[model samples]
Target chain A: MTLQMTVSPDFPPAYIAGWYIFNTWLQRQSGLPIHLTLYDSFAAQRAVLAQGGIDLIYANPYDAAFLVRECGFVTLAAPCNRADEVVLAGTQTGPVNTIEDLAAGTVIARTDDPDVNLMGMMLLEPAALHAGNTTAITVDSYPLVAKQLLQGHAGIGFFLEEAFDSLSALVRGQLRELVRSRISVIRHVLLAGPGVRAQQVEHLTTLLLAMDQDDRGQAVLESMNLSGWEAHSQEDTEFMIDLMDTLDTQVLPG
Target chain B: MDGYQTRIRYFDGHSRDALIREHEVPFPDGRLIVSRTDTCGIITHCNQAFVEMSGYPERELIGQPHSILRHPDMPRAAFQDLWETVQAGRKWHGHVKNLRKDGSCYWVLATVIPNVRHGRIAGYTSVRRKPARSRIHESIALYARLREAENP
Candidate 1:
C-alpha cells in the first residue's frame, strides 16, 4: 500500500522540491510505495489531514502539535536541524547590533510562517519593533531574506536558525548573528496517520534516523536544510503540546 | 553568543548576599533563567540567571539533576506532568517554585523544549521568565491542592 504524505507549502519552492526528492528516495530505499503531496496552504493541508487523505506528514512544530492534538496523528521522527530558535542576521559591520537596533531600520523577514515569524516578532515587538510598520519588510522565503540582508537592502533579516544554516558559506561568513531566540520544543515533526501500521512506522523511523550516515542520504538532507532524523520521544511531544496550549491561551497574537 | 553572555552577566552576581526568606525574590523583566540538560536530566550548561535564581554555584549545578533546585513545597505530580509532557516531544510551560542555597524560594514561568541531534534527543533546555504575580498566586493555590491530594 502506498503511504500518502503531505508537506506544507510554507517553505520556499526549492525546499518543497527537496522534500519531494527526499521522499522519492525513501520509496526506493524502503521498498514501500509512497506518494508525496505539497499543499499550497496550511488550510488545504489541514483539510486533507482531517479527511484522512494523508497517512504521513512532515510539518513544522506548531502544526505538528496541532495535528497530533486535533487529528490523532502520531509523532514519529523529526529532521534535526540542530537549532531550536529563531535567528537575526546582518552584515558584521552593520549598525543593527540588537533587536532594538532594527527599530528604525528595515528588517527583512518571512512573515508568512506563523512559527518563525511569530517568534521573530515576539522578540522585536516588546522593543516596539512592529512588523506591520515599514521598518519590517516581509520576504517570501529564507534564501530571499538572506539575499536581502547580504545585499545590504535591509539592515537585518529574521528567520529560523535552519534557514541561516542553509545559506552558502560565503553569505554566512559575511553576516553576523545579532540574536537567537530560546529553544522551542522541536523543529519539524514527522507524524503518521492512524491507519499506518506499527511495523511500517518503526521501519520508516529507523530508516530516517540512519539517513544521515550515508552520503546519498546526506545530500538529500542538505537540500532540505536538515542535519539528520532523530527518534521522536514521548516527553518532547508532550512539551510541544503544552507549548501549543500555552500559546493558545496567551493574549499575544502570533 | 553575544546576547547570551550579556544576559548572563546581568544575573551573575545579583544573589551574592541572598538570605533565606519566606518571600519570593522579584524577577527582573526580560531576563530568563536558562539551563540545558542531557536526556537523563543532568545539567550540562546553564546561564547566569539560572545560577543566581537557583541559589547554586555554577560548579555545584553543572552535573546535577535540575531537581537540585526542587522546592519541598512543590507537588510531585507537577514535575511528573512536566516530565510526561516533554518526554512526549512537546514543549511544556508552567509556573515553578524553586529553592536556593540559602533556603530562599522564587517563582518563574518556565518553558522547556528538547534538543534533538543526530536523530536522537541530545538534551533538553528550560527557559524561565518572570511571571505575573497573579499567575503565581493561582499556581500557589493549585499546587497546595495538588500537594494535599498527593499526601491524602
Candidate 2:
C-alpha cells in the first residue's frame, strides 16, 4: 500500500509546489511510495485524518494535540528556528492605533486557523473587546484578513506572523501591527502515523535533518521557505501539545 | 449567445446588476474545474471542465474578468473574502455560486491561490470541485443572511 502525506493548509501558497517536490524527494530517498494529497482547509484535512487516511503530515501545533494523542502519530521533526506566532494589525490610517483603542463595534477580520485566531483574541483582551463587544468575520486566508483592514471594512485583523511578514512590502506599508504573540514554543511539526514502520521513520528523520548540508536538499528547503529540520523528541512533542491544550482552554469564550 | 446575452448583463469589471434564476447546477464529483486569472482578475486560462461547467466556450471566457461568472445571489462579502485571501498570497477555500453562460448557476467548492512568480504575485489560480450537499445548504442560508446584512 502507498503511504500518504499531507501538509497543513496554513502554509503559504507559494510552497504548494515545494511540498510536492519534497514528497518526490522523500519517496526516492526512503524508497516508499508516498502519495502527497493537499487539502484546502483544516476541516477537510481533519476529516480524512479522522479516518486514518494520512500516514505522514506536516501539521500546525494546534492539530498536533489531536494527531499525537488521539491518532497515535509520532513526532518526527520540526522546522529549525520557526515558531508559530500571531499578529494583530490594522490599517495605518485606521483610528485604532493600538489594541487599547479597539472599541465595542470593532470588526475583527480573521481566518479559521485556530491558534492564530485564539492568540489574536487574547491580544484584544486589553481593549476589552469580548465576543459580545466585537464583530468577528472569518475569512479563508491571512491576505483576506489584511484586505478587510485595507478596505476599511474591518477595524482590525489577525494574521500569522509569518504570513504577515510574507505580504508584499507595498501592502505591508499600508498596515500597522498592533501586537504580536511571542509564544515561541508552539511550532509546526512533522509526524508519522501508526502505520509507518519504526525503521522507516528513523531513516526519514535522518534524511530530513541532513537536508541543509547538501546543495539540492538546500534548494528544496529554500522553496518551502524552511531553513532545516530538527529532530523532535517525543517529550518535546508532548510538552508543546500540552501547551496547545492549555492555550485552547484559556482563550476567551466566543 | 442571444439567450446568454438577454439573461445576463455584461459589464466591464462589475456585475452587480446580473439576473438571478434561482436555479443551481450541481457540480459533478471527482471532476476538478480549473481557471487562471491575471492580477486584475481577467481570465488567462480555463480548462475544459471549466468551459463545460460555465456553459461558455474557451473563446468567450478568455480576456474576461472573473466577475463575469459572478452570480447575483452570491454575497459581496464572500467575494471580498476571496479577493482579500488571494491578494495576501494565501489559499482560500469556500463554496461559490457561479453563473453560467446560459444564465443558469452552479455551486462549487472553490480553492483559489495566488500564483507567485519571482517573489511577486503575478496572477491567481482557482481549482473548483464538487461541493458537499450539506455545505451548499449551509452556504445558501449563510450567504442569505450576509446579503441581508449588507443591504439592510
Candidate 3:
C-alpha cells in the first residue's frame, strides 16, 4: 500500500521542496511506498488530519497535541535542530523592553498562520492579559512581521529565531530579542494516524531514528536542518499535554 | 499600506507576591496566583499575584502557554489528571510545584474551574492560593514517587 505522508507548510516553498527530496530518499530506503504531501495552509492541513487522510505527519508541538487529543494520532519520533526556539523581537530603540511594555498602546505583529501564531500566542499569553490592552496585527508571513516592525507599523514582532536571523545584517542589527519561548527541545515529530499498524509504526520509528547513522540519511537530515530523530518518550507526551492546556487557556472568560 | 490598529484593554491591580529566592518560597497568605485560559490552557488573564509568584514580569506571562512555568520535576500524570477532570467540566483541585525564572520553586493549592458561557465550557479559571506546608510536603513525596514510577 502507498502510505500517505503529509507535512505542514511550516517552511518556505524552497525548503518544502527539499522535504519532497528527503521523502523520496526515505521511501527508497524503507522500501515502503510512501507518497509525500504538503498543504499550502493550516486550514487545508486541518481538513486532511480531520478526515484521517494522511498516514504519517511531520507536525509541530501544538498541532501534534491537537491531533493526539482530537484525532487519535500518535507521535513516533521527534526531529531536532541545533537550536530550536521561537522568539519575540523588536527594534532596539522600540520603547517596549519587556512583555509588560506591550500594554494597550503597543502594537504586536505576527503571521496569520496558526502554526506560527499558535506559538506566538503561547509565548505571548503570559504577557497577554487574560483581559487587557494589546492588539495583535496578523500579517501573511514572518518577513511581514519584521517589515511591520521595521516600518514602525507594529511595536512588537513574532518569529522563529532563525527566520529573524536570516534577515540582512543591517535589519538584524536593528532588532533585539525581548523574550524567547525557549522550549529546549522544540521540534516537529513524525506521527502515526489512528489507522496505522503498531508493527509498522515501530519499524518506521526505528528506521528514522537510525537515519543519521547512514550516509544517504545524513544528507537528507542536513538538507532538512535536523540533527536526527529520537524515539518518543513519556516526557514528550507530557510536554504536549502541557502545551495543549496552555493553548486552550490563553483566552480568558469574557 | 495605510496603518490600521486594534486596541485591547486590561483592568489594573497592583500586588506582589514573594520574590524569587534560592530556597522553596511558600505561597504568601491572601496572595493568590490566578489565571484564566481558553479551553486549551493558554493563559489569557492572570492576576498580578500569578505574575509575581511566577517570578516573571506580568507582560511575559500574558500570552504564554501555561507550561512556561513547568518544573522539570513535575510528573506528567498530575497534569493529565487535571486536564481530564477539567475537560469533563468538573472542578479539579491539586497541589502544584512550579519553577520560577531563577530556578527556584514554589507550591500552590490550585483549583481549576471550567468557565461556562452560553451553556458550554468557554475556558477555565485557575485560582491558586498558598498551599499548606503539609500538603506541599506530601505532594513532594508523591511526585517523587510518580517520577520514579515513570523512570522505572
- Tell me, by DockQ, which candidate is best: 1
Tell me the TM-score of each prediction against the true structure: 0.59, 0.60, 0.63
Interface RMSD of every predicted model, in angstroms: 7.1, 17.7, 11.6
**Candidate 2: deviation at residue B119, Å?**
48
Off by over 4 Å in 2: A250-254, B1-152
lDDT of 3 by residue, B39-134 (tens): 867888776777777888878887776776766567777887888899998877777888776667787767787775446887787866444454
**How many Å off is the CA of A136 in candidate 2?**
1.5
Please tell me how candidate 1 rates in CAPRI terms: incorrect
Off by over 4 Å in 1: A10-18, A40-44, A89-97, A100-109, A125-138, A143-157, A165-177, A182-184, A213-225, A247-254, B1-127, B130-152
lDDT of 1 by residue, B1-152 (tens): 01111111101122122234475676653355777788878999887878877768899999987776776667778878888877888777778888776666788777787765445666787877655555677788988998888769
Query: Weakest 10 consecutive residues, lDDT, candidate 1 chain A?
Result: A245-254
True contacts kept of 2: 0.00
- Model 3's chain B yields a TM-score of 0.83
Per residue, candidate 3 scores C-alpha lDDT tens digits across A199-251 of: 88878888888989998888888787677888866445544444335444444
Instruction: Tell me the lDDT of model 2 at B89.
Output: 84
RMSD of each: 10.3, 20.0, 14.6
